[model samples]
Target: MVIFIMRITWLLVASIFHAGPGGYLQYVVYIVTSLGFVRQSFDVIVDGIEQSIVEAHNNLRPGKIYVNNGDLLDAGVNRSPSAYLNNPAEERSKYQYNVDKQMTLVKFVDNEMGPVGSFNWFATHGTSMSRTNSLISGDNKGAAARFMEDWAEQNGVSKQKGHANSVDFRSLHLSSVLPRRVSTIIPEPNEITDDLMQLASSYVASGGRRLAASNITRRIRSTQENTAKFVSAFCQSNCGDVSPNVLGTFCIDTHLPCDFNHSTCNGKNELCYGRGPGYPDEFESTRIIASRQFLKAADLFNSASEEIQGKIDYRHTYLDFSQLGVSVSTSTGGQQVVKTCPAAMGFAFAAGTTDGPGAFDFKQGDDKGNPFWRLVRNLLKTPGKEQVECHAPKPILLDTGEMKEPYDWAPSILPIQIIRIGQLVILCVPGEFTTMAGRRLRDAVKNVLISGSNGEFNSNIHVVLAGLTNTYSQYVTTFEEYQIQRYEGASTLYGPHTLSAYIQEFKKLATAMVANQEVPTNIQPPDMLHKQIGLLPGVMFDTTPIGTNFGDVSSDVPANSNFRKGSTVNATFYSACPRNDLLTDGTFALVEKLNGKDWVPAYDDDDWSLQFKWSRPSKLSSKSFATLEWTIPEDAASGVYRLRHFGASKPIIGSVKHFTGASSAFAVR
Candidate 1:
């Protein structure tokens, strides 16, 4: 039986603005995990926050904060490919595939010391890893965060002179915002074979020692020390319609661009794919894109001088989206009431975005439903007349809200929250919001916050939309975009008035916050923990080959091998399933350098240069092996180094056991 498990975690949003004893502002670091491909559990988030609090307490000192935003268009639209293919040159030129280039940054600076930490907000999708990627990664944004934090550590903290007492923070913990631009230039199918794609994916995902490392080192070396225990967050914004594949989409087979309306090649989407800035080499593309964002953020951080001063406050509440009534202004300056429909996916949703095209006959801009697929949809659940009329222009493919036999397919209840720090307001949304949708929401909320303040505030009120925060409700597109029946519109679970409903709800919250009024709590979502099911089988046991033992060297580096910078050193060992223990706060592999008589730690699994890959050698046997690869850096000191692997083995009857292995020393010159 095929089962789809929607692992959704309903987490309570933490208060970012907190005051300590003596009313001093306390720094609270909240890390937003990479939500692409991999999902972080609630327990993991709580544990991470708890750990961050301890670290922040030691490193972060309360300081003056500033907020500023700059415009730098590093991302483009993936849907533009389809528009270019389907429309005339003049018509295509008229279409504006909006790219939100605004990079907002919040920096905490100490008056006596220097820079403490920074929080950044930008809209760019994490799909730089691509769908063909098998390994888990943080994509471009994650890479940027690591680079900034590492740069801060190596140059800002440890290398600073004469400010040792003020910069006593030992470690830096990085957290990023989750907003994304859905557009990215992906590889053409024919241009890159599946094996080559996976290989490139692994190479990039492994944090290859390429342009990023050298560029970061040079940039860090050129900068002066001002930041201490610096934490950087690349948070998400309204990116439901954004794509990182900036180069546009094309047909791999014909080398022609895909159809603009449907994003299909010869009426089929399987052969259509998008391309990024660095084509052929996705890793290079990822680095280029990440570097653009980081450089822009760095510039903004340096120029930021607007001080944020006001009381810290926040308001949160959950609301049932199904059949929620919202009042919107009419074209004639009047108000009208409209209701949202139950969650349902449309046909165009199956076409997927240009970043990752879907299989079969489905295509984008498809409004009419297929007869055969309708039969299949009915076998699951049929949409009633109200639902059909409610989601007009969107041909229903899955009546997810009505289907509850096995479990809830789509969320009906979601959290809507607003946080305020002085004049900066963050609207924490539950799902992806398209470009125009996000703009409208921001404008509406900003207007409300200003007007509701009754002349207390002016045009300086900064409103930011934080998308995909509490839960996933798919996408939210503008009403006009909804009529286009594109992938974003089709995936918008609610009706065309979805964005309108969100604006209404957020305005209500904003007004309440400005007036110090209390809002009533609504119904809570059902807990699906008891209904959860695991389809993937667990590790029964682990064993080595007949003559080999666990942690035994299967493949070792060549004897007396001499390597230079930008080279990769590899070692393989007979291993067990890494799932036996997650090794949280631990290392799976390490690069140790010889220091006279004793070996000292140089790098661990957390470093971008090191990659740990696990695989089963045989299908029938429970035999596994792990390959540890370390990409040499540009600033490497000429020294002897060795690789070490750590793992755990589980037996069918007995308990789990841990083991370690090491490789022979190799020289780096």
Candidate 2:
């Protein structure tokens, strides 16, 4: 349940918050009062309710805020080195790797208890673990969170007054623009030797370590100590056009750079793949990138001194963006009214991004779509003349607004929310906004907050854009970017005037918030919970090799083995589908050390050093096995240890039953 909850939170609404030690009490109150059900989806409900609760808390302490900025992330996808070499100078300049490196830290201290909690914001995609990764890990950001939480627990911060030892409330702010900067392409089958291929296959089948984020977390943990229940949140920002694949894109076949404008190789997108800083070694690249972010953030956290002072306030409203008239300033400083059109994806949207190239012959910067695809798109939902005109220069591919058979394909009604924490304003946008677009929106809102506030706000105001909040509505790009029609621009669901509409609506929200006036909500979004579909099949029944029982050990630790730090202990057991029971509150594997008389748990699957993997011999058979691997940490205690596996099995006609297995005792010295 927790795994699903985290996945939903990360995917649906990337916003997270940590209440002080007493945060659980607030959630209890929220759930009991029925305020938790404010949204239709579980992820949205959590995000919305968290906003309310955090705002409520903000109204109280309204503590001092500090900020620091550093160019730590190489997130701009358009700034790929190969793109720079292939594109014209002017075009290259437009997509320079400009990232939001600002880290805003908010610290709340009780007069008597000293510091109680802290919150922070930064921008980077949580894609250190590539698509090839099969484990259900939180990638880098999650690793950083766990590291900080673990550090707090180990250092006795949880023992402070008013701190709940077991409670660590975290909120994930999904602020990435595109995908992580990591490559999403898999190695070619021909490139793998028989032995190496088998190892690679087994490594995945037997779960692998999430290196990058873990490295960052460990670095920070080893160096920092806190006096309070510190919550370090690596929140995302305007990364709509940003990617983690910093090395750049190249053709796999010829080893040459891909086409700059379209990101294709030999007229094909499939072979055009992006590379990370570590190039062939993705894990090394992840570590390199993670190190950069961790170093910068740590420096900022330690040196941030400017104190932000003001009132805590927020405003939220739902608006129908489709057909909304927006006033824009022309080159002559004259205002022109333009209306936004219905949601429609452009041809380039299917071309994907450099981090993960699209299939077929589709490519980026394609204003004119292929005729065959156009016909295919028409079969799905044809765009009307108005939509075609609204999204000029962008050839429509999927008319999402017109496809409503299985509920709305894309959201037309989006929630616009602005949260003001003292002088820092958080623009909780429901979609990914490109760098320039995000900047324009931030500047527009900041100007409104200052100019329209009538002395209510001043130059000290700071605004941050939080993307992918509350809901997912695809992307938003500048009008110029829309004209270019790259992936980000093409994915801009609304018409070309989309950014303008967002700027206008957000300014209204800022102005209303400044005046303490209520902006009436527009049409509410429909409840599509009933139309939700579960495509994945559930576990049927569990079986093992003919003679082996569910808990029977297939492979055990070697006898008389003397292991040391960094040594790995391996064990395998006949098992059942883990989905039968997620072990939400427990673990599938453990390392138990023998004491004088009793066995003490030294580690569990939750620890980074322990890995649990399940695999079936064949898809046709339900028989399966689980492998447990425990890599001893440098600080491991010298003692006798053994591996343990916990599982649940379901019979064809009987209830699910739990089982346990153990490995031969070994010495770690």
TM-score of each: 0.81, 0.77
Question: Per-residue alpha-carbon lDDT of model 2 for 1-669, expressed as tens digits?
Answer: 010012112222363211101111111211222322222234443565566455544535423445545455453344323322433447437554555555555444455543444455566555555555556555555555444444333433322333333221211112211111001111112331334322222211122211221221122222234433454555667767666567778898999988888888988877887787777765445545554454344444445556666686777788888879999889899999989888888998888776667798898889889999999998988888988988888899988776775456677788888877667788888877766778789889999988988887788776878777766687888787778888877888888889889989998888898888988875898776655443334578987767667767788666556677677889898888886755544677877665554655666676566778889898867888889998776556565667777778889998777777777777665
Going through the candidates in the order shown, the clash numbers are 31, 11
Position 154, candidate 1: lDDT: 48
Cα lDDT of all candidates, in order? Answer: 0.68, 0.63
Task: Please give the TM-score that candidate 2 achieves against the real structure.
Answer: 0.77
Candidate 2 local lDDT, residue 220:
22
lDDT by residue for model 1 over 188-230, one digit each (tens)? 1333133322322221111111121122111221233443446
lDDT, candidate 1, residue 8? 23
Model 2: residues with Cα > 4 Å off, grouped in runs: 1-97, 108-117, 152-230, 306-308, 567-569, 594-597
